[model samples]
Target chain A: MPENTQEGFIDQQKVLDNEEYSIKNTQSIIQKAVDWFRARSMFVLAYGTGCGAIEMPPIFTSRYDIERLGVVGVATPRQADILIVSGYCSYKTLKRVIRSYEQMNEPKYVIGLGSCTINGGMYWDSYNTIKKLDEYLPVDMYINGCMPRPEALIEGFVKLQDNIRNAKSEAGYIQYRENNAFYRANQEKIFGKNTTPTFEENFAGMNQ
Target chain B: MFNFAMTPLGNLFFGLTLIVFASLLLIKNERRDLPLHILLFASLGVIFYASDLITLFVGWEIMSWSSYFIIAKSARIETLQKYIIFNLAAGFALLGAIVLIVAFAGTTLYGEIDFGKVPEALRVPITLLLFVTIAIKSGIMPFHYWVVDTYEESDHIFSAILSAIISKAGIFLFIVIFSQIIGYRYLHGSLFDILAWLGVITSIVATFKAISQEELKRLLAYSSIAQIGYIVTVLALLEGSGIEAGLYHTIIHTLVKLLLFVNIASIIYITGKTKFSQLGNLLYDYPALFILLLIGIIALAGMPPLGGFNSKFLIYTTLLEKKKALLLVAVMFSSASAFLYCYKLIYGIYLGQASGDKEGYRELPMSFYIPQFIAAIILVLLGILPSLGIALFNPILGSLGFEVSSYSSLFELHTAFASFNGGVLMGLFGLVFALILLLVTSMRSKAVKVRDRYDISYCGETPDPQNNLHYGYGMGQELRRISFIRVILENSTATYWEHISKLSGDSSVMVKKLYSLGTQYIGLFILLFFTILLFLGVR
Candidate 1:
């Protein structure tokens, strides 16, 4: 989807302008490689709604230490790797929740928490509750509880760690390249065909 | 400690920049429709909490103007003008109050403010000015005209932030002013009494209009107003334990309202359906969202064991313990009246037979559902565990010079007697029964029917399902019949200021006309004006 930046546009322009693209080319390639490597530090956008969000502070703080785990909380989905749907979702919250999830990067993981994540838990029937968290998204891990304490939440962190390691080891970069159809289908089901495209950034003029 | 002096709202400001970046890239595409307003909201939480009043002021103005821009995006120019006018009025009031406080106490620092140290004469005016600013921001009664107009006009995502955080920040500021800074104990109870009455009036009136409205978003707007009234009334009460209960209501209300508003947006997004009259058979098309919205509506309506009931119950018990009998009646009336609006919201959108082919609408993506899913899960979990709401309120209450009550998160709310066990027990039992049914249905029914047609058999009369099952059909009509109470409350709360604005406008015009009576008398009028001005100035 990205426009051919290096060889096609830059090289062609150099030939037309009779300027050398070779002088700074190697330095640029090294910098690009460095950026790609550093950007690999995955940030998770923890959209913690309920009691499970209570567990996040401990996980991120000095206790369990999510930062040591190389997982820090980011503000928006675009900057995140994991989307933690901590607990209970109402129809009211679900709308924004869906928007946040869609906002995340291509390689994303969704973790459903508390008993509400698996089923409605105690509020299975008083209405205004979702029965299963997976029904809405392709959840990687689902933690069970009426309210999961901090200890169990750390356990979820460990499990997610293991899953990431395993997927990376077996699949290589190929799995990363694999189109996320499950995530795609979830998006299609929720947003429908008339997706308001994200073309707001009008970077109309750029020499590069 | 995060250095308040250095990075006051540092986390929030960076977040705001990201959203602005996203909005700038706000190509008219629907896929990336998050406006800059959404990002700016993250800024508000940090700004209001800063220890320095100067830092607080910056965040305050940014929040005001950013929100103003959002309103301007959707509302007519005139409405946007009114919105900004009201906000500017509050801003000027805030500036005047701060200047007076600085003059009297010789400090603009938040930590240095000591109400006891301030001279008595300056105290009342300062307190009055601060309270007016708080009232305007929180949309309490007469100063609240901006909220309804803004909510009705805003994009749903922006409205959700406005309802959840904007007013909350105002109430938060008021708590900071009254409890920590001003400490006006003698006047506290009477002030709350008036606010509680205003909340009752708004709830009774808004709930009535909420019931009658055919447009779904307007009903949600009314619901936001009524919910905020309860929040403001609780803030006015300012009790130690009630702070937790009040904030618990805020937490649950935010989660619950976000759930409802998002679901409302989903309906709008899916079918482009705005009114209840234009919508039907959604369950047949978008089943997942249908079921999700159904649960959200129920919990919001205060069904037991869901998140809404926990806080609503706590609010009731708090009133009862205070043994404010009249307050209890008002609480019950507002709580009960909510059902009318909530019922109409859900049934109007999702219930009844399908309008046509079941395949017309597709389910929304995980991106959108994630937001609702997170909020919904929290609502019910907290509802069953009302004590969780209190525990969360502990740190917030402690900052305001209050001790955190040891309320039970499970069945006991801090104090044993003050807690609620009824909703918890009932909710647990319901979950068990539903699971039992799910197992049985799966056991007996291996192969389920996959028929897609939602239409009825041709054995019948004119079979327009949507026409027959339109919103405003049964319950909506019945609610209208009992709507006289709403009509009364709408006319009931006309304040003294409404008449004042009218009176001043007319008086000023007459004075202007009298001064311009005739060109011939202009010289004499000028001479007389100078003579009178000199006499008054000399005295």
Candidate 2:
């Protein structure tokens, strides 16, 4: 087999035409463009749960004016590309996060807020708190701080945009979807069992 | 030996092995309900002992996942999702920081990666990463969502372990980076002040939140956040005394939370009623248990003559010396709030109106009660003799190389505690209190009436048939007075997060428009691809 870095080897093998991007310089070039566009495409989801949520106001409205950078906040999961787990969750909130994540479409990203969501922060020992957020779903970025500073959050935004632009994720959403059943099952497992009348009715009727 | 992979490896391997063993020997077969806890503890322990960054991270991640599974196993999937989302967010942030640090540090080894070797620019970001991870785990304000829900929904004993042990991961990480690697000197001490407010505000908000909750588990959860706020506040101090106070609080909180959760366990098991609105009049059946609960609640409330008071005193003294006046006020306010909740806990569960007519409310298993019993006794013993727990914890602190305090003068309050003649004061106060109580009793007539329905929040209306009104009790009711405080603590951050999700959805929508006829997106992608190639060629 020819070395991947060597032109003679890869060209001769003609390994399924899908490998075309790997051999070309265009991928890097295209990435640069994506990043350029991503930098300007500033819309953010304000998924505040913890104290980190506190910093967003100054950043978005007055102090930092993240809006100047093209970042405006959104309101619903369906309309969002980024899901921020602003703080830690109990068994109860985890269910809603899953539902929200399910509602989000492709090319989605998740940003965690505050230290609590990171590893239960200080409540790491609390029997009610989950230690980390990533056990159940994918995360794209994390804004550090018990509640991250507005600057740090801005930094997080830039880093995410950079990742989005640079990632060689030209492949369709099929790969992302294949492993999502665990998420669905996880969502079902929690939602299916809530005894609250509102949810109970949904569980009984929605399954059919 | 404590390599990056090793820590997570230890946790992952041990977690699986224990789960297997629990399934085999403990339950002897298919899906025994027991393996859940053993797996949780084992995984958590291995993660704690993890030696390096990646391994520690991996172990931490896996343990978190497993614990989330345990909590979600309760079937309250909504809370589980919040739990999962919050944890994932923090985990990703930690990972981003770790990845960046590794990129700069050139290694993932826990000890080998020296911050000094890295470029000046990267150190603050790395410290921020570690700090954030710890803060999230610690349930510092804003980050404290998952703790309450998971605690409320999961098994009572599970909540106990979670509150007692797993939560320390945040402190462990804090110690790892804050005192150890970062040196707490970053950004010219500016960040410290922010962290300090983080603690103070969180304390105020969380305490208020705790006071307002009605459900036993939810109340416990908020209380848990308030306690964690104290710990974070101490860490923000960055002084030896402050660190000591924080560590001391950690130790006390660990004991107090364990006992409290165990007490909760006993109640949950016996009555199966989880909310304050549902439970009542348990003192008649379980006198011994009620006494234990009282002690636990007292200790948790930071009342005198208990372990809670000693630690609270230390924290209060430290804050005062640091001159964190607002925090001082917050601490006192939170304590006062504690009295209300603790009173509600007792009255609502054991002294208020009983919900059912069940004559046979049997006691929980003796095994289940053992933990609570041990916890309460220790709380009392530690309260009586703060030196005992302090002496024991000192060695652990020493081994961890934490600098101990020599500030005898700091704790000396409005007249030195040692010199103020505490014994004499106690005797005088006891006599005054007793005399006052005796006078009040003598003054009261035999026809003094105390009715159940007269409580103010409950006074508003009767139990309506259609919608059971949730009388905003505790901090919830109190929040109504301070509505303009921006005191909305629910995950309102999602409004913006969802907006971002929408943009991504919009991106997909745009792509769909490009290919709505089943070939738009694909064709556009192709057209865009070729257009770029041809344009570049033209250029």
Candidate 3:
């Protein structure tokens, strides 16, 4: 990581797929069974960040019937599994969304729902919305569209479920733990001293 | 003359409440007003054992005044005024009923004064007056404005007693007066119907009110009102099983409140915070208290394998037996919403994230755990063997002039429409619980335990310890947006009661002018008296 003294921030020159940052899950029979069930039953916390939220209702309702694929919407983060960041997240929304995501239990995933989450879509020049979702948090999967249709959303769910089942890539929650320092550094750059809690300052002594 | 008689209903409530009082004695709090607690309990005994209206009235007055003084010790002026005013009004109502009964029957003794001997028109008024007194004490709707304030302002330990045992004094009075004094034939009409409706409405409204409360004790206060509402509704059936169900529920509520309030008192004693927003994440530091509260909530929500479920089961069966589908549905709705507040009670104090500085908290004394464990164990035993409760109530039911409903065994409880075999229910619940526990433990190796509580999935940002992460305060705030709930939550009888108080205040001020010694005022009073006399003479 290169320090950018001019902006007092880290230079984001390296791709997120740095080999040193790769995370993996241990393969076992019980682990496979657990992952299969968890993949099937995804409780999505569909946080509507931008226009993409308009597309979620149809996917959840009779048109798509996402419930058939064992994906359901929950009211609280305590019971949620997958958090859907539905388009570009403003700094304010990002703070709350991060808070909601942290409240969720283990074995959780994040899905960057639209093109804005990829490169801030049309608002890349806006002062608020972050361009890359993965810079502040782990993005387990991303579906491409200005606003993904219900069909595309369902397809995204399918691909994510397949990834979860096969353990094909590092899970977002595991990466969050192993490379938390990097993510926290990026978050602090955007949020300054007001960033969410740091693991070292807040939680380090408590973990015995 | 001191005359005392024991009935099944009275014995059951008095004995169970005595158990609660005994449990209270186990707590070694600084503000344990031991003498007042004893006075309150002894007065309850007097009310329950009274064979005459005079003795009941005496006992009632003692109980009310003792509790008022206890509350006055730490309560604010406004809270004390509300408490005393309502209680005094209830005391007057009871006295008026006694006077009316004496005027008609020419005696105060229960065995001597027969409702049949009284004039037909006087019977309804007498019953209603007595009903009003009970309603006020039990904190029934419209008459319940004083309860939350009193509960909130009192010492937490005393709040437990007030909720657990004192409120039940009204139910005891109801059972004795309605069943034995007034008799069912006089009450098989619109009067009891009004009471039944009032009870259900109170529960529905109180359940919603309880959900919106941010203060822990105030929430429990509303919950107490709701639970007592169910008992009142059941008591209105004027049937053997209905009374039994009411008694059963009364016992369960007493135990649940005692356990919960004491557990909360322990938390408050340690942390010195009363609002849900001010407290959080004490589960690890006080894991035992957490489990105790969990048990309290489990029973309070009336889940299986606890005495709460047994009582609720009885209440449902009685309602169904009476063919009250609508009432049953309303009761179920209230029960369902109760889950939200019950979850809040546990989640607010223990789980989620620590909201404020918990460093100031210290270890709770062992005295707190003694009462909690006692209540928890009894609740479990009653859940496992409900027959014990029925057997105790059988003699009381027989004494209440109703045929004792027989159980097949020590563990089976049967009603006309349904039966609950406690042994079987307990066995099945235990078996399923054990299997799930075994299965979960077997897979424990595969499941990674996140060592850090703060190490939760956040979109990609870390969570600040200072940030308000515990949703305890906001848990039920959104319920206000629901149309039906909004209607109930927005409309309260407080304004009506306030108007009544203002009216009385104005009348008292006008009367006070009559005592003015000014010449003009005195001459005006004389002129009004002569004018009234002249008008009467002309007529």
| DockQ each | 0.01, 0.01, 0.13
Candidate 2 vs 3: which has more DockQ = 3
Candidate 3: segments with Cα more than 4 A from true spot:
A1-208, B517-531, B534-539
- Quote the lDDT for B163 in model 2: 71
Considering summed lDDT, which 10 consecutive residues are worst modelled in model 3 chain B? B444-453
- Tens-digit lDDT track of model 1 for B1-539: 22143232232233333332332232232533355455465457546556656656667778888888766667777668657877787787787777776676676666687656667677667766776677678776667667676776777666666666676666667666677656646244565677667766666666766776778878887787777777666656667756656666766666666667667777776676677776766766667777677667767677876777766776776777676678779767877888877877777777755444334445554555655676777766765666666666666666666776765335555453355564556667788899998888877323323132222222212234445545443555565344566454345333554576569779999899978789768878899999999999999
User: Chain B in candidate 1 has what TM-score?
Assistant: 0.82
User: Per-residue lDDT for B268 in model 3?
Assistant: 89
For A1-208, candidate 2 gives per-residue lDDT tens digits of 3346454446532442345543343447765776566556755666655556677678878878877767777776555667777777776667656556544544567777777777788888887766677655566666667767878888888777765665533322233355445544554555565412232222233234
Q: Residue by residue across B1-539, what tens digits does model 3's lDDT show?
A: 87898766667777877788787787777776788888988999999889999999999999999999899989999888889999999999999988988887888888787777778888888888888898899989988999999998899989999999889988988988888876888664678878988898899899999999999999999999999999999998888888888988988899899999999999889999999998888898999999989889999999987888888988899899889888889899999999999999999999889897767777788988887898899898898888777888888888878888788786777777877787888899889999999998887444434556776666545566668899889999999899999999998888998899899999999888767669987998899999999999999
> Looking at candidate 2, what is the lDDT of residue B303?
74
> In model 2, which runs have C-alpha deviations exceeding 4 angstroms?
A1-208, B1-32, B186-188, B396-402, B406-479, B482-539
Q: Each candidate's lDDT (Cα)?
A: 0.63, 0.64, 0.86
Compute the lDDT of residue B475 as modeled in candidate 2: 27
TM-score of 2: 0.58
Q: Which lDDT value does model 2 have at A198?
A: 30
- The positional error of residue B322 in candidate 2, measured at the CA in angstroms, is 2.4
